[model samples]
Target: MLRFDPKGPRKNDLSSWRPDVVQIWSIGEFRANWATASDTRVGYTAGGAIAFLDVTDGTLLRSSIIESNSAATGGGILCEGSSPHIVGCEIARNGAGFGAGIRSEGGAPLIQDCSIVSNQGVVYSAEGAGGGIASGSGGLVVSRCIIADNYGADTGGGIFLWPESRAHIVQCLITGNDTCWCGTFGSGGGIMCHSDFATITNSTIADNSACISGDGIEISGSPTITNCVVWNRIYVRRGNPRITYTLTKHPRSGEGNIVADPRFRGGGDYRLQALECGGPGISPAIDAGHPGVEDADLSCDWGLGGSRSDMGAFGGDGAGIRCNPCIQVFGIPEMVEYGDVLNPVILATNLGTFDALVAVVTGPIDTTIPLYRGPPIDVAPGDSVVLERELRIVPSIPAGLYRCDVDATLRGEFVSRGVFETILQDD
Candidate 1:
């Protein structure tokens, strides 16, 4: 453990030798007050923690930075004219007047697979922005990250893009962020974009709240959003954004845009529900993304048997997880007579890495009338199993077109569903 006193000089010289690479590994913790003013390249590996660091150029991987406080910008990381590759790290509970988690002034920075959460941007003489990140004149790429539960005093609870900055956000989740100040000055709870050009794709921005407007995103300059999900409001004060194949609460004028509930798996699981996977219903966001994109599983629509991609962070090439036990129903009769016994077959394939315990249940759509229930079957990764069930149609039942549903349960929870329509006639 290394601790630096707050009373130390605001700028300290840690080392004089300009090494080609400085690797800090296996350290327990580092509590520093001021930023490291070195142009030398640095890398912090796993098993180490940093309270704060001023990064000029470096790569930080699998580290933790938490609870640092700064009176100025970037309580956790201040990047000045430096392009650092920060990946697989957790940055949380930091405070600063601007960019509590990270502040990039110039140069292109790549932040990937990180969690920026619970940071606060304090008001500094009416100047506060970017609770999670602030990009001031730079090209920043944030990919496959979760930025959540951050607070901004003025605007941009999750991220702020200053003028002349360009940010490319892909396959990220920004949620539960807030922006407020004296109940009158807040905006852009998820993202406040004033940059020259910003492009957001395959991301999920939801449950953000602002004091004034733009609970999901507030745009001042031209930005392009595609194949994303915005559960909250998006207010454009200036400039027009090209939004396409996106899902929003309110309908926006764009190609493939839809207004519907994303039906996210509850309890912080942002994955869209597929009834075949034991969800109560299918989410409209499933398979409703850009046609050109593909998920990590090489499936166009999150591997749920869709031609197009999904519209959320779980879609695209950087999706977090693969679908387990992708069940498909087949051999269901299209027409049947009353009092006839029918046989249906279903195939369950394990697409995930681990083995899965699965069961099969067949019944009428939205009913508890289980026609057949199979015993638990163990499925290994990349393996498939076929199950058959006999379903008898009662003669006393009314003659009509009915939907027979096959639900696959994983560890007692339904995760997938398959349905086929059958015309039942009394003959």
Candidate 2:
């Protein structure tokens, strides 16, 4: 049980350096440089617990575990010249003035099986580099980790790779990330690479979205992308597949890949499947890519079963995002229109480990059930419920907001009552 704040800095009278626990409360901006300032030998395991602390240390840092902050700029961390590592940490609500959640500067991070989500970047600025992890100038690696739900005003919602940097991602997932004002400046919903090199094997970057440029995997520098599944890319450069080049050691043929939809079993807890609207198919990512970098991956799987080198993240065979637990089910409309269905769209997300089969019913009969005959049912872990009823514009149907209650069921267990509201429109 921990608490946090993004308004300012943590308490001045900090606690003694605990090798097991460190919960900081960062209101605005505060620094947590973890290098022993003097000659000491305290083996503080990097994955203990660091909750609620934000600041711009050296350049690159990782305030992992039990840690929480709404920091911007070199967000949750900025890997300066050292290897600021964070294991089993949580970075939520934080954004970047420049580089959000994480600014992976020059070094080799030891991030194993962690979660980085919700962090974001604002406006169009080079400052907010990576909404999740900004990789730059060196050997930065992320393995068996999940980086999702982050936001970026410009490029790299999940990761922004600067020039001259390199990454070795394995069995990881980067999805559901979004860019500000879609289709504007700074693209790449999942990853935005300018002039660098990265080898993403057995990883997943799906359902990620952007406005103008690359949606799944955006590459500019001569990168070696092998056996990875890239699906739902908005507007990719047709016939200009140089960005997604393959990994050729000898005659490096720029970028390379299978450019196909691996057809994941379940995208994740969100249950949002891939729908091929104007572009490619659901799986089979249209172009099998050039024959040159075919042998790049050891997993051979294009978008079907697992092979040697994977397509995108999970080698075309991996689990997607699970249901969110800490989601609050409530709503309050800002505007309403005629015929425009009026009802409460209470989205109760379960971010906890277990499923929250919560039931949110109406208080009185003020608002009708099944608004507009739409789908208004129960939502699971990472699900949503929308209740609406058609409007007939009766002789005199007042136009105002109505209220409701929010209840919950944790594994058939019911909780107290909560409150929410909605609005009604007239003809």
Candidate 3:
């Protein structure tokens, strides 16, 4: 049995490194960074965290565990018949033959609020499967996770569900996963279900790639897809998976289905920030969800008050502590003449649930202009504040565009940032 401390050392501490043993612990966290298991033993070997040898059972909560570069099955965690419940954990950068991050063979596990990223599934016997997670028989339930940057040698870059596996994936962002092995013969970049039953709902699958087919998802049996935004192709070769009320590039005859870009905040970041602001390049899938669907994810909050459910992984009222602020620049002339007062005003808003103090700065100061600091303004939730500063445009100044920016901080930590563009005209 093993024990952990909440305020203990980092995850890479020597106390948290457990090799191949059936370790048991209470509610605590274990972080494993740059851990290694050099044993070449096969069959559900956990190089990073724990390896359930026989019929062992345990539960883990609020833990960050990982295993790196293993020659066996599970690099991060391996479970045979032990039912382990993992919550709010981060499993990353593990490598194995079967399941790089996690391998569940003979037990049912519940994984929620976890970030499984940058894992790999190498080829040992014949083919590599399940870069992020590989489930053999016992079903699993995953919710509200960020699974990204995983790779597989054969199939199932993000997740591989083998035959007779029953898994339910809800409200997860699956992106930047790939399977490009043996001259592009791999498939199922995001998920590959070669099983009988799999249910995926309220998830976003985008920017995943495979060599031959099924860039987003590939299934051989019937699966249920609801309220999801799949930016790539869903290759179904066998059973007809009833997909409805979702946003995809190819929409069949269904209720409230559309084909449009989800308008992600950035590449690899599948969050719908454009919908919250309602501007150009906004995703049409916002507020276009089925009311009959229920949100089962217990990690993050979504959507706005008194609005319909969102189509993708995020839905409901956009609440909580947000460090992303909205910034706008004002009183900047396109063409400025020499010997004129260059007045620039920057407006910044705090959209989060905390109060922040904002600071503004201008660069490319050619002349010594007298500047004064303004008093700190207290910004509440969903509030905006303006910062005014004056600069004198002298004759011996450079005639180019000047850059202005604002930064917000909470408790002396930088949280949000805004930038402004100003032009200096030639005399």
- The TM-score leader among the candidates is 1
Worst 10 residues of 3 by lDDT: 1-10
State how far residue 201 of model 1 sits from its true place (Å): 1.0
Give the lDDT ranking, best first: 1, 3, 2
Tens-digit lDDT track of model 1 for 47-144: 01222233332333345444454536776766655545566667787777788888776655667678999988889656779999888865566777
lDDT (10s digit) by residue, model 3, range 1-427: 1212222233334365343332334334444432233321232245455454332233444455553545357767766654555656778887777788888776556566789999988786776888998888654666668889999888999999887666667678899999878865688999998865566767899989999889899988866676889998999878767677788977655777888877776745566755345535666776677774323232324553235667777862111113245544334444567876644444444534223534354545632222223334444454333334556767876777766555555455665655655577665
Per-candidate local distance difference test: 0.67, 0.46, 0.64
* Candidate 2: segments with Cα more than 4 A from true spot: 1-68, 124-126, 234-260, 267-312, 315-427
Highest lDDT model number: 1
Give per-residue CA lDDT, model 2, range 107-165, as digits (tens). Answer: 45435456878876765334555777777665555655788888877778788777655
Clashes of each: 10, 70, 8
Angstrom error of the Cα, residue 17, model 2: value is: 6.0
